[model samples]
Target: MTDASALRTAILTSVPADPFQTTAPEPRFVYVPRTHVRALDPDNMLVVGARGTGKSFWWQALLSDAARATLQIPSMSRGKLQVGAGWSENTEPDKDTLAGLRRAGADPRQIWRAVLLAQFDSGVDSMDSWKDRVDWVANHPEAVAKLIRSYDDAADADDTRHLLLFDALDRTADEWTERRALLKGLLQLVLDLRSTKAIRAKVFVRPDMIQDPEVLAFVDSSKVVGSRIELTWPRHELYGLLWQYMGNAFQGAATFRRRHSGWKKDETGLFRMPDTLRTNEQVQRDVFAEIAGKAMGTNERRGLPFTWIPTHLADASSIVTPRSFLAALRTAADETNHDSELALDWRSIHSGVRRASEIRVIELGEDFPWTKPAMAALEGLNVPCSRKDLVSRWTANSVMERLDGLPTGDRNKNATLGQQGLLNDLVEVGVLEVRSDGRYNIPDVYRVGFGLKRRGGVRPVT
Candidate 1:
């Protein structure tokens, strides 16, 4: 086929099939954003991000030497750190055991300490049940502290460190109260461990969880929150990530890399984006223009494709997650005509945004079940409307009642705040926006997926 056809085929294959399904991302796919270096530091215990961000990806990445090496963090480069999952999306401790321990009056702090200790000490791990382990930890506080200190000392002597990672803490408990208590306990444990020289804990938490007052109620909690780093993918970094994938693709690596002279491979043989490409928008735009063309259309009025792709995909908060960004391009590649001169057609890019929106809605539902019904209540309602109209739509559809009637665990705690509260909740999560004029507006990313309309915005795909 022609060069453009071959390039489009390469892009379709290069981009991940599902960026959010990153339980075990391949090593070559680990493209670290420059801004995220702080989050990789062992010192930063709390790393926060919204859904579809790289929390789970980084959690899995850090465990693999190949992935960690790509991060180039001094602490992790030596391979001297022993890393273990204290809790993860897939590797959580038994829920029934935790429930039994909580019911028996075991402090959440003690429960988590037992969990951490079990990762190192065979004696702690040998306990047949969580009850026995937690009970042992509670009764032997001094002994537990002493054992942890011994591990710390050993790590220090070896010039290494031990890291315990926690992710998906939302699944730790069904009830909001129980989940908060468990999280508070884990945060408390994180604080206590910070004093150790060679042991550290990294928690990849959702923004809502970390910001909750009840969860951060412990002493010196601000220290953790104050030092927390957000996992974000800025515009340049998003484009940089795309190039990383294209530059590393098995088929079009040479052709794609030739478009940007700054791209180079690291010691691990993976392509590394230059510092300029990572920070310079013009440089990024120039490189991207080679594949997608200069403008989204025959003229510039339709907007530059470099900016248009992300603008349409951004949430109300103006945050464009890497998952959505990549998803859009992948769909764009798939929809582009094979006979087209450009690798990606501008019209197909719009289709990409639609697909990305659908994907975002699905992800939101997985994290917050209430979102689907709440948005369903507003379907077909034109946005940039007054708050009264928004509330009326919800009331008419009995949205609040529907959300409250959801199963005990599925109910969003925010739903208890009534209609206005639900609006605030949506605004907080970047699904809805309250404009300066007090009108409610939904960002295009969510607007299309939820079947809402805007007077002059991109139409939702049928």
Candidate 2:
């Protein structure tokens, strides 16, 4: 028992306390300034941004916070269901809850059908349910009528603000058609449900995933795209997070000192952290400079300071998501933890970026099997390929055909689907960028990995 107690203490001692722990009981660092405070308002909002930008954290946080407040929007639970992440409609509590509600006069089938339509359609369906739902919602006047009636009944019961937090609609790993169907269904449902002053649903989504031509046609596109709070960890914020993370990691150490130490004595004797942990300016300088350095290589001169780091080297217009940030940080931390000197070294961080780059390449390579071929072709030409030329020559080709024809003998039928999946996966993962002109390009940091030139253009690579 004594030994067990000692072990537990040691384990607890190693655990780091978070510095940016949300003051409002429920906190999500992603979407910090925007969603944290404003989300609780009665107005229904569409929190749009890039994936990993802290949408889920904020959405869940707000929901949890709402639980503690005066607001009452029916006692419905927030369900975490993303396609491929879980069986959306098959879960027991959800299915049972909806069934129970339906038995109690709620249109469980209709409400659920709308929820599924709003969340899951992504174009690649060979399934009848997908088509049926799309057609039912789009073609039938009855479907909309039924939804409005359901909303009206709920409103009559004083259950007006039915906040459905569609957190991960963009996280679905579905085909384009299914993706399109889901997006279109969401807009249709939104328009139909808006008639009821009582029913309001907030969709937290990634902008890139919603760019389907079909969905865009009906959507106020600008409402989502324009007001989207791009999840970016600017220098100051990123630095603060890093500092807080490290301070927590080193908490309880003899060298650990809080800012308020000796504050009661002398004003000049304020206890700031040691230099080993990053300051606000140092983190910004280091992150940007490191990103820039990776692209510049040994030359060490040229490129935007923001572009210098691998994390932001993809597109200035592109926003970094929380998942990507976590990936980069975990890699950097693993490397930092292993080094004899426990410090956040830029070289170690860059090495972490390279590791992330490799994973990014492999992920993109799988979906758009043409990814590797395109890179190889770029390497052969030693010049940037035009967007038109790339799509026709590579993106249009099947993964098997692309790999079977490669000169490197890296072709594998077993891995062909994996390769094709990579392209779509990378785009979903935000490693590759699809340009407005329909061209695909890799980040400049990744260009070095692929042995290609550093040129700025929107393009795809996984």
Number of the predicted model whose lDDT against the real structure is largest: 1
For candidate 2, write residues 364-432 as lDDT tens digits. Answer: 454344457645554422224455554454545554466667543233323445545545544554545
Q: Model 1 residue 61 lDDT? A: 90
Off by over 4 Å in 1: 407-417
Candidate 2 versus truth, CA RMSD in Å, comes to 11.5
lDDT of each: 0.83, 0.42
Q: Single out the weakest 10-residue window by summed lDDT for candidate 2.
A: 80-89
Instruction: In angstroms, give how far residue 87 of model 2 lies from its true place.
Output: 9.5
Model 1 clash pairs?
none
RMSD of each: 1.9, 11.5
Q: Write the per-residue lDDT of candidate 1 for residues 1-462, one digit (tens) a residue.
A: 666776777677678887667556667767788788889888789999887788888898988777777777775665388788888656646666677788899999999998899988649999988888989999998999899999899889998888899988887876767888999999999999989998899999888887779999999998878989999888988987887777777676777666667777678888876788778999888877767887877788889899898998888889888889989999988999989998888888888899999989888887778888888888888888888888888889888888888886676657667887888888888888878888888888999998888886778855
